[model samples]
Target: MEIDYSQIKVIGFDADDTLWVNETYFRDAEIAFGKLLSEYETINKIDQELFKMEMQNLGIYGYGVKAFMLSMVESAMEISNNNVSIKTIQAILDIGKDMINKPVELLDGVETVLSTLSKKYRLILATKGDLLDQERKLEKSGLTDYFHHIEVLSDKKEKNYSRLLNHLDIKPSEFLMIGNSLKSDVLPLINIKAHAIHVPFHTTWAHEQVTEKETNGKAYKTLSSLKEVLNLIH
Candidate 1:
């Protein structure tokens, strides 16, 4: 079913995989680290241990390159019997820096969709991540101008979403949340009775993936690509 954009006064978007290639970069880094860890253990073992570290750290550090880099260092030490050297530490940090330094690659149809939708509705970039990292990416992507406000937050829980709704002076029905991660973007907004559009992305980061069993009905509508949103808007 196509949603009517006439009532959607504000459109909030999740920054990473929704608009640009995000988790793929982190996955590349993880695969690189897996190769490094393979020198000491089996590839499967490395994957299991890294996944464990990621789960443990997500509760502590949340998400971003910093948590990911530290998780890598800790995983290397644990798997290698605490034999981590300066080189290993440097290698982990290097991967983190690589992700930060990587060129921002806007996903297919993002520019066209955003540029088209911006003309009608108030566009807001609502993303959660490391502040500096997200800000740098927004500047580099050259798509920043389309947004009237950009929220760089460490978390996108119900409280933050509510605050943003109030800050924009918009009701839940008047806004639509467009994002990839159902856990971070869809669930919280749904809790507040907000409408959301889900654009399922390929290559989800380990931490952000939500299995089918967790989804709620009536809260979100999944789309194949963002271009669909443009079609809905205009």
Candidate 2:
């Protein structure tokens, strides 16, 4: 289980559930959304449809609350046969506004981990989703000073990481990524011959879930807490 960090020069971190509370808000929003459409469909059905709607609209709307807002609106229309009241539509928009306005809640040991890690290795924040929202959260989180570079990616596939590393003049061997989602943060780096660490959050979006077979032989470290990272990195 021993891995080398001696050659690692830059560390890329996924900003969502890894650093702050994110998926939980989305989960709460889904419950709110289900209630908004409760008269039209059951909560379980509404939840499934909303996820499907999001998957269908991901390419066009991208990620973040704005995208989820659109999906909710679309799903409402389809679920309600376009008869959703204007008042209900207004509530849906308000839901997104509330999400955007919510204060950033940093995870335990986040500041300490970043503060300690940034001393030696270069630290970069590489999160996926809307740039504006990510920027807003970073500003609110008061952790902006920790990063040398901050990027909001449309997606987090291997190609995206490759392009980012190349742009930063970082060889894959010298870069490491740390995050909650295996699909977005860990496997992509592993595939590209970079190191990654998995720090699982309590709630993961369905899209971020990966099969056991996909991770069966992946070379990455998993820690119970963000604080645990300090033990290995130094």
Candidate 3:
């Protein structure tokens, strides 16, 4: 594939799995909390109740450490006959805080790739989730300098992409979104006639990974990793 860098101006990116590890951390915590919840109730019952609440509130709270921690608390209380203690709640909150303050680690080769792309395209981060949580991660990741603009939205859908394009004052055809999550990152961009390069992750968050097969889809391309983006764009 031939890429004309001159034809592209702004490049938008999804934050979580796109640039750094996100859901895996949450999954780990959930499993740990599951062990504790299982001591109080059946594992299957706990999982069902928690999953239902999470799916319901995904849009309202967005993705963040705090909201997830609270979801665990609610799930535990609901399943355990409302016998959850203050200590258990505190422990969950502590875990979430630790994740927030934890040192940010960039995905392998992310720094180098973004550094190369920044020089050629106007880099814009178009991540959608909790504002403060996403902001803290971006700041701590040491990647703030690599992007020209950072956007934190309540959601990433077709309308969000359209608004971003308008704010950038760039035509949809001139921008490209490079990230994981085909549903959120690629399909929305494709809807507006923009280019998208999907970098699939091994384990995607349940909310982010919705299977939609489109073999004949145009305006969107899929790859195995972010490193391939360098080849496609340059």
Candidate 4:
């Protein structure tokens, strides 16, 4: 079906893994964390425990490296029976810092796509993460000027996107969201009767994975890369 986007007045973009490299760092952190506690548990166990910790702390920490850092600390404490060395704990903190300080490596065609789309429609960044961290990354990304508004959301759900529509003074049909996560970026918008485009990243977080049944009959387009969006919208 040709989903008409001529009525779309606003386009919401997810930041991490969509605009720049994100999950890769978290994956790297996990690997580093596993090595730190190699003596405590197997790598597989550490991975499972760390993910469980992140999920448990999601409500309290929301989403971001800071939260992930805390989860890592807590998991380390538990995995090591609270006997993990201070130096190892310090190493985990350092891993988070290194991730924060890492350069904002923009995805391929991100700038070209954003610059071209910005001239045609109202482009906004609707992402979920630590506000300060997101803001800092935006400042570093050099693509901040391409967006008119930046919303660091607590979560990406129907109500959240609906509030965004109300704030933009647009109906659901007039708003289109694009991102890599089907769970967070696509399904919610589709459920709310809004348009969404899925741009699958190389690696998806386990939390963002959706069952085939969840997307069985949804009306949306999935593109291999953000570059293809221009061809679709144009």
lDDT of 3 by residue, 26-67 (tens): 777877787777778777777778778888777666667877
lDDT of candidate 4 over 1-234, digit per residue (tens): 678888888898999999999999999999999999999999999999999999999999999999999999999999999999999999999999999999999999999999899988989999999999999999999998999899999999999999988987878998899999999999999999999999999998999999999999999999999999999886
Overall local distance difference test of candidate 3 = 0.81
Clashes of 2: 0
**lDDT order of candidates, best first?**
2, 4, 1, 3
lDDT of 2 by residue, 115-207 (tens): 999999999999989889999999999999999999999999999999999999999999999999999999999999999999999999999
lDDT (C-alpha, whole model) for all candidates: 0.85, 0.95, 0.81, 0.95
Higher-ranked by TM-score: 1 or 4:
4
Residue 4, candidate 3: Cα error in Å is: 7.7
Candidate 1 per-residue lDDT, tens place, 1-234, comes to 555546778999998988888888887887899888777998888888988998898878877888888889999999999887788779888999999899998988999888888988889999987888889999999998999999987788889999989988999888889999888888888789787888988877666777777783544678899898776666
**Ranking, TM-score, top scorer first:** 2, 4, 1, 3
Please give me the total number of clashing residue pairs in predicted model 1.
Answer: 0
Every model: Cα RMSD to truth: 1.7, 0.6, 2.0, 0.7
> Global lDDT for candidate 2?
0.95
Q: After superposition, how far is residue 101 of candidate 3 from its true place, in Å?
A: 1.9
Model 4 lDDT, full chain set: 0.95
Report the Cα lDDT for residue 156, model 3. Answer: 82
Local error of candidate 4 at residue 38 (angstroms): 0.5
Best candidate per lDDT, number?
Answer: 2
The 10 consecutive residues of candidate 4 with the worst lDDT sum are: 1-10
TM-score of 1: 0.93
